[model samples]
Target: MKQYTIGKKAAVIVLHQLCMILMVTGVFATGYAFRHDAHENIDIYTLISLAGLVGSFVSLAYMANVAGRKSEDDYTIYYLPIDKVYSDVMLVIFTLLMVFMGKVISGVKNQHFDYASLIMTAGTFTFLFDMAFIILYQSIVRKIKGNILCTHSLMYKGYELLKRVIEKKDIHTQKTKEIMRIQEALEAISEGALDTTLNVNEFHGQQKKVAEAVNHIRQGLMSSVNESLKNEKLKADLITNVSHDIKTPLTSIVNYVDLLKRENLENENAKYYIHVLEEKSQRLKQLTEDLVETSKITSGNVKLNMQKLDLVELLYQTGGEFNERFESRNLTIVTKIPSEQIFIYADGRQLYRSIENLYTNAAKYALENTRVYVELEKADTKAVFTIKNVSKNELDIVSNGNVDLTERFVRGERSRTTEGSGLGLSIAKNLTHLMGGKFEIKVDGDLFIATITYNII
Candidate 1:
């Protein structure tokens, strides 16, 4: 089939070339006959030449269509700089032939029928046919070798450059989206969402490395948090078990101490020893209870019984209960309770415990003969309770320079000379939080202020 197709194209091309040659020969012959006044000989040659020219034109159209179909290779011929130079040389040659033909035709205008005129005319016609055939052949080549032309042309190069630019832009856009996803993942991680992770498979090159790094950080954070939580649970469990174990033996000791006290011993030294045992045992009991309570609060084991309570009544009651202790220390209680009732939602027992801890803290630390100020009032949507007292010791010693007092076992006095456990503030802070309130402590020089705030109902 391929051989047959090639044979067919060759036949058409041969026929076209023959027709062109015939047209050129006939035209020259007719022109020559006309110049010599041979009108009778012109008719048949003129008709033949015209028919051949028409046939050549039809063949040219068919060849052009064939060239168009094979346009994929049209640009292949002009890939090199030498090809351009060759085309320029051909154009110059064609121009020279045209000038030569013009001169020959002018020379033959007034000449007689002879070999000189015949040769000149034949040469001119041959050159004209050659020029026309070269132009037509080059046009067909341009169409058939389109790929080569496109590869070399400036417009084709510009198109390729534009395509590359668009591809680069698309890559950049994909990278930007990956960066944004990584940023969002990082932000979520920062906000304590440890479960957030980056998809490493969705990225490539340096972006994939970044995604892997982010995922590594997230896993590390999750592992660390899990380890920390495990340690916290173990610590809380230890405290709970120890407190329970001590309670059993502590109960027996308390019962024996009570029995010894009721024995009515007459010796003064025996009485003094019993009194010391009772006091130490009580202190130990309080410490044990504080440890257990702190463990429960930290481990989230405590349950709150939330209720609406009047702040004015609660504060007044707390003040009354601690009034005697304050008086004994020569510390006067200065109350600033609002007459209007301020209601807040909280666990009543927890709130009372928190308040009691604060009062105990004040009675233990407040300076002698100084006025302890207590205030309860409504502040916008919240109920604010504040207590201020002058410290018995330097505020620096109590606060320890920017140390958080709410931390477990943190204390006002570093020397361990105080009577109560250091968990009072910690317990109060935890209980306040459990009840959905805010607890704050401020020490200004010799003045210590503690504030509790809760949203009002």
Candidate 2:
């Protein structure tokens, strides 16, 4: 099959159709000669040739099928291994039937099933059977390499699925039954399933080890998760206390800066120092507040007051509030909101923050003098709030792909002068999840799109 080029594959198909024509004509000619009783010294060469011709047709059909069933130019992509095997088996059966028919026709044309006809039938079956095995073996062997490479074998596939559930931090939902079952098993173990032991009866030998390892890994993962969660709580407590601790002294500095500004200082440089000190102190204060807020939001410290709210009205309000900021950058807000008021179940305050972060993010980073698009779309049960804009800085795919972007302090740029603590998107993402919504971020060329999808009420 590999020897056959694209043109050859097509040519083989055409040749198979020609063989069918010859087989039909041979059957009719043999029939006509038998009726006239002019079959004396009958030549059986044509009958044998027709058998070989049908065999060739079957072979060509099998080759054409294996190559063209997938994306035409590629051999690596196969739909199903079992289906291919079944087809090969069927082709062999059909070729054998054709050869048997030729033998039967010869026996009938010549008087009785004599020694020659018997020899011909046995010879045809023996030769064709060997050919059948070779063809079937080749078809199955080709699939073995690809299937093994993808870890699709029973044991390998199960092992790989378990490894993923154990190693990956965020457990994603899967749609496949086998993987999904394994995922659920991991969850059961993580959630303190006392029977972490896999049934040794169900799996044998090394496969049993894989199941045991999955259970072992799950136990270890649960322990790690519990410890990390404790540490996280302690860290959140520390951040909250530290922020409060610094706030008291930071408040004193602000007061002193304010007092110094009111006093008549003879030195202009001294007054200038006070102004700079005030700005730095204020920025630190803002950073502390953002940190404490993000920690609370992410760690489930913040209580969500979920309620039904008009999404359209919220968008309008958020847009209107940022009108001045957008105007400062000479950026226009292009809205594609639905005409009617669309309501959804969510924490109004949190949803406002999420929408505000997206809008403000676009307004700040969007190319100056360009338009920022805010569209509200609903399909089936989900409602989408999408905002797209051209970034002011170069949007690197490597950075975007590697970084979660929703993780705390994971900024796109290394520079601190970008006017954000980089907690904006993180906060928005967490808040959305807290309110039972999905958030997605995509970067293409200079365009940045952030979409938040939630169940429509």
Candidate 3:
């Protein structure tokens, strides 16, 4: 079916009205001719009238069947023979036919001035009204909302406005729907949707191009993420292997160094060298073990054993081990813990380690003769342990400065004069979180603070 433009429809309306008028004139003229003589020979006027009747019927059928109806390319089951646009046109045509029929009947029966003239006059007025009605119908089509096929199919009144506009699809319409589908897929992917695939087969031209591009990007992203994860796993495995390899040989060296110390050899320099060697080897072993443990905590490889314990007692116990070292650094430990026991549910080993890290960190770099404040108290539903001290080195603390320190190998001391592998805080923080505790650290100039909060039992 050809597409109907406004100009084409207007042409159709004009032709239909002219056909109707001619048909009515012919009908009246033929009726009068036959009425005058029943057996008159066939004349040119009668032949001309017959042709007009045939042409009128053909014109009526053409417009009634095809005009304003959708050209559906897909299979559909339409229960109604006539669609909305044609139905209204048929109603108007029927009403006009009845009006013309009545007037023609009157003119035929009346002994009026000229019957042919009266019939033509009746048709002239009818065709005028017919043309006006068709124009009004075209005006109606202009007011339908965007996307008529989706909205106007409820068998309601005034749906004729969208009757001619509705179609299964056109080239532009198919392209629009495909473009929308592509956009929907893009949104889903951006929000981390993984399972759904776009229907590239349904699209054409640029829509298909867009869908394929998105699919390719998604594949690339998944590949990149997987590759990154694989590389991280290999790095973690390498750290574990290196730690184990160094520890095995280091254990023998430490044992031999201690054995040599037990010998009563009067060689002072050899004994001192053995002591230094033992100390340096032990430090190296501790650093390697810390690296491996940090990896395990981060990767969730360590199993936890949760139990109820007094948080205040645990803090005092951790502080005790670091007391001699704290005094050596000229730092005094000050406790502000509640006298009442505050119990919490946590993995004892990991919790103790987290606390030890904070105390050791303070003791190692706290300003000499300054107090390292260790405070434990109840805040809402949590038992909070806070450690604050004045840092020895000139510190540059900004927003996120202390938070970033929890990353492995990030240390406050640039040259690492103090004995630490920099994995202490990272392991402590990760293990704290794994055991359902919150660890936070803050640094303001020389003041360094670490707070660990656990849910009270």
Candidate 4:
């Protein structure tokens, strides 16, 4: 299809050139045949030639228009310095030739051979042919290099240089403004202002693209955060409802299990089974209570009774309570307490529970015959409490190397063979936070460390 179109255009251009040549030839022939007194009486041959000349000239004009339209469609003609120079030179040559031809025609005698007129006519025809050749040559050059012709133009280069020189400062100022705006938007996002949006229309080019991209990121973050919050709320609500519903049935089961244990049983197997049922029912009741507590803490529905409490006394009490459990596993307890009392403002019940959870974690996971270190010290205006223990199993296998221990239901034992609901660390961490304290857990090889810090009062 493309080849056919090219062939059609080539045929049209050829016809146009032929018409131009014919028109030029006709003009030249009439000028050559003219005599000084030819205007007095017109011959039949002259009349026929004149009519042909007018018809050909009309055809040439029409073809020139067609060629011009084709050129305009394919190539853009820029009037550059070179074009101006070429036009001026052509005008000078044509003017000189026309003056010389006029002088020659005026000097010719009437009814003679008219040699001067013939020479002038030939010269005019040659000039017209030269003009046509130059036009064709320029058209080819413009077609090949049309796109880059402006860049190559001296006038265009000068204009560009001048424009840059005049607008350099303005460009720098605009760029600085765009950078500051982008930084401001990023800072706002970092500070949890997801509602902030960048105006893309105020920027141009690459800056505009950057602004649009930032706005998209901000919107995406807003959506993600909202979805996460909604899901968290839903999870909390589900846990709360389920725990409440289970409590009623669990109370009846506990009461019945207790009643069965009290009644005398003749079958030894039945008595053993009833004992097992009582233990399992108690475990289930404790698990339900933990779930309810966790839901309340996570949903920010729990209250704290903040008061001044001694960190040293809390640590001692927690250690004493866990002494028997640690001894059962052949784990030794080492205490590092400062002599001076360090008091912190926090909820006493919550703080004790947080410390108790740490002790429980150490007793459950610590290696047998290993020493567990418990410390309470005052540092500057803060009271720090820490517990470190060596695990019986590989820390990597227990928590998969990097799983957060404080996440709900995340336990150190992968097989979950240990007696725990896996909510101890989570409850502890949330309780510490509620009492305006910091909680962190670190695992290194077989070593596990849990630290809690609060502002001293």
Compared with the true structure, what per-residue lDDT tens digits does model 1 show for residues 300-396? 9999989989988988888889988998999998888989888899988899999999999899889999998998877789888999998887754
Model 3 quality (TM-score): 0.55
Q: What lDDT score goes with residue 371 in model 1?
A: 91
Model 4, residue 132: C-alpha shift (Å): 79
Each model's lDDT comes to: 0.79, 0.71, 0.73, 0.74
Off by over 4 Å in 1: 1-172, 396-399, 415-418
C-alpha RMSD values across all candidates: 21.6, 12.5, 16.0, 18.4
TM-score against native, each model? 0.61, 0.56, 0.55, 0.58
Off by over 4 Å in 4: 1-172, 199-209, 328-330, 393-399
Error of 2 at 85 (Å): 28
Residue 210's lDDT within candidate 4 is 92
lDDT of 3 by residue, 345-410 (tens): 998888998888888888777889999899998989998899999977765444335447788887
By TM-score, the candidates rank as 1, 4, 2, 3
- Per TM-score, the best of the predicted structures is 1
Give the worst 10-residue stretch by lDDT in candidate 3.
74-83
- Displacement of residue 281 (Cα, Å) in model 1 is 0.3
Return the number of clashes found in candidate 1. 10
The model with the greatest lDDT is 1
Worst 10 contiguous positions by lDDT, candidate 2: 169-178
Arrange candidates by lDDT, descending: 1, 4, 3, 2
**Regarding TM-score, does 2 or 3 come out ahead?**
2
